[model samples]
Target: MAQQETDERVSDEFIDDTKDSAEREQAHRERGTVRPITVVGHPMLHRECRDVTAFDEALASLIDDMFASQRAAEGVGLAANQIGVDLKVFVYDCPDDDGVRHVGAVCNPVLDELPPDGRVLDDNNEGCLSVPGAYAELPRPDYAVVRGQDATGRPVTVRGTGYFARCLQHETDHLYGHLYLERLSKRERKKALTMMAENTPRYETVPNAE
Candidate 1:
């Protein structure tokens, strides 16, 4: 998803980085099996994913695979449905506007309501792995918070600012059956799809039926 660095700034307090986070992120990718990403036209990408109920080894494995797939696609964030699994889980390894890296997974994510006083908009170029090779300008909250469970079903709250905030919002939208394209005007959306059709994604994808 457009990892383009920007001058977009956020308060340092919102950054969620721990010393072991990077090491854990690396370990997941190493143990994961990369899976093909499902495209825009695929049914899985168009519908809401099932809320994860079991927080067991199977869920852990899926999160692992998601990290592997996101790395393969060179994405900052990924949702379970993007890998053809209809589960409300997403993994992210993104940096805030300050370039502080934040890495983790969220299951059954619910975006916290942005307060009117703090609702600053950041209009930036956004892309998706499901709609590969295309990006469009979209405005999103410059800061975001999501409440969900970790892979082990532990309650978790994640907050971010700048580009990482965009990543959180984008991945949550995926779980709710929405794509960044949905926020764009028809003309822009068409342009992005045309761009995708004209170029080839570097990563493997599951083709949608014609």
Candidate 2:
């Protein structure tokens, strides 16, 4: 059996510091004119992502761009909408049992319920690039069966458990116009919003409010 594990000490800095010059250039080119990271309240983030149709150069390029954005932002996973693109795609780089990096992208993805014999639900702290600086403890199924295509449009099926499953579930939610905050309990949501409201000052002095 394949074992899965996540090393929390693996920071975003590790990704940035390790990428070579050519990879960096390719990433920048893939992102093109679009910004790599989009903030909260962006309409694209709330819109349901469209399916990938062609699987041509554009689709492949978008996959690269998603990976670039993921690494640049130091996120375990990223969705197309988070980068202002409304395509059903996401990229993830997580550690294996040996703590080696396993990076990949998925397009027009789908997640099925874990096998009846699999593990139970596990709650973990999760954050999003779209909602920067906010982390929440969200409950996620302990395992997931994902089906999607790779950069070259080849079919792929992955059975993920533990943190990898958590990351995949999180990214899949973004594709469906859902955010982690939506899964929080009412009291949790209120507390989180209050914290955001307190830490994020609103500039009432600006003319927009008046």
Candidate 3:
């Protein structure tokens, strides 16, 4: 009977802790403002992000701003460089084929420290908000092991396969001055460029009669 009472007390405490945390996070979101999304031609998107040292209030505030911007833009992932910040961090929330949700943010992510023994696959429709109206076929390892921190500075190591792995690698690549289009094959690159050119509008003038 005593053991049962102890378990009940522990469960109650856990619930209270979770509720408090959620409330605090919501309040933080309310207090923070979202940053603007940077486009492809921006120099920051092509530059590597710096490692985060001293995860203090500034880092926490940046993460909150990123989350807000991501939600506002409705993107699956966003990097710090995407918003002109040079911090090595990104957010992701992708849905599976069956509509299940997997969402999280990773700060100072390190990837592929392990051997790339996993199979590589082609995802032909990768798109980035920064690269507007652009889609390319990028080759990616179907599985990867990533290590990083969560929003609250807790260490997290995740081993993912399939689309989840693709998302992880894609965001991590953004931190390192790489875009998915850079991973396309030579033929695919030509095709993508042609497509981009065709989509671009050219100003033309009508011939005048003498």
Candidate 4:
């Protein structure tokens, strides 16, 4: 659902195009990079991501690929695992309820403190890039302010209110071992699973992590 090609890859094997990580970075910087999305049920989707220790070219390239993929899929945000990387990073270009755009990436993020009154998801429902074709009324804080380092190890903060808030929560959850489905109640979870079964398998075939 996301990406797997350097905008200039213009050929098959975009995912296999790189001989190594350095080449991948070069390809990404030259143009947009789109990595194939890791579908639901992929082991990485259920595991906590590793912290990003190296604020280097590789990290920046990965972020670029994420943005390219998110745009290709027409998604609002994307996390590392969603594209088969297990690093704590995510990118977004989501809009608030007022249509103001918010775009950037964050690594090793910590969500802001919620309002003392607690919070809930918007009535519009929520979805995930990994769990394609499925969405449910998942409750999450209605606002968010995430803080972390950028790919270059620079301090960064992202704030959101309204739908952008949901995007922040959703992407952060991906860095953990949680998907939107896990946010649903037992009954709702069952319903969502059934709906996905009636559609194309998120991954044409299940992925093996080990």
Q: lDDT: which candidate is best?
A: 1
lDDT of 1 at 49: 88
Predicted structure with the largest TM-score when compared to the true one = 1
Give one digit per residue, the lDDT tens place, for model 2 in 31-53.
64333566556667666888776
Q: Which ten residues in a row have the lowest lDDT in candidate 4?
A: 9-18
Compose the digit string of candidate 3's lDDT tens values, residues 95-138: 54445455566777777444555466746477676654557867
- Per-residue lDDT of 30 in model 2: 67
What ranking emerges by TM-score with the best candidate at the front?
A: 1, 4, 2, 3
Candidate 1 lDDT (Cα, 0 to 1):
0.86
Off by over 4 Å in 3: 1-31, 113-117, 120-122, 190-210
TM accuracy, model 4: 0.79
* Pairs with steric clashes in candidate 3: none
TM-score of 2: 0.73
In candidate 2, how many Å is residue 12 off?
A: 32
- In order of appearance, the predictions have TM-scores of 0.91, 0.73, 0.71, 0.79
Model 3 earns a TM-score of 0.71
lDDT of 4 by residue, 1-210 (tens): 112133321222211111353443334435666667777678898889998878897887788888778867668889988888889898777778887666677788777667777766566688776776777887667778777766677666677778988998889989987888887889998888787767774333335452
Segments of candidate 1 deviating more than 4 angstroms:
1-16
Higher-TM-score candidate among 2 and 4? Answer: 4
Query: Candidate 3 deviates by what RMSD?
Result: 12.0
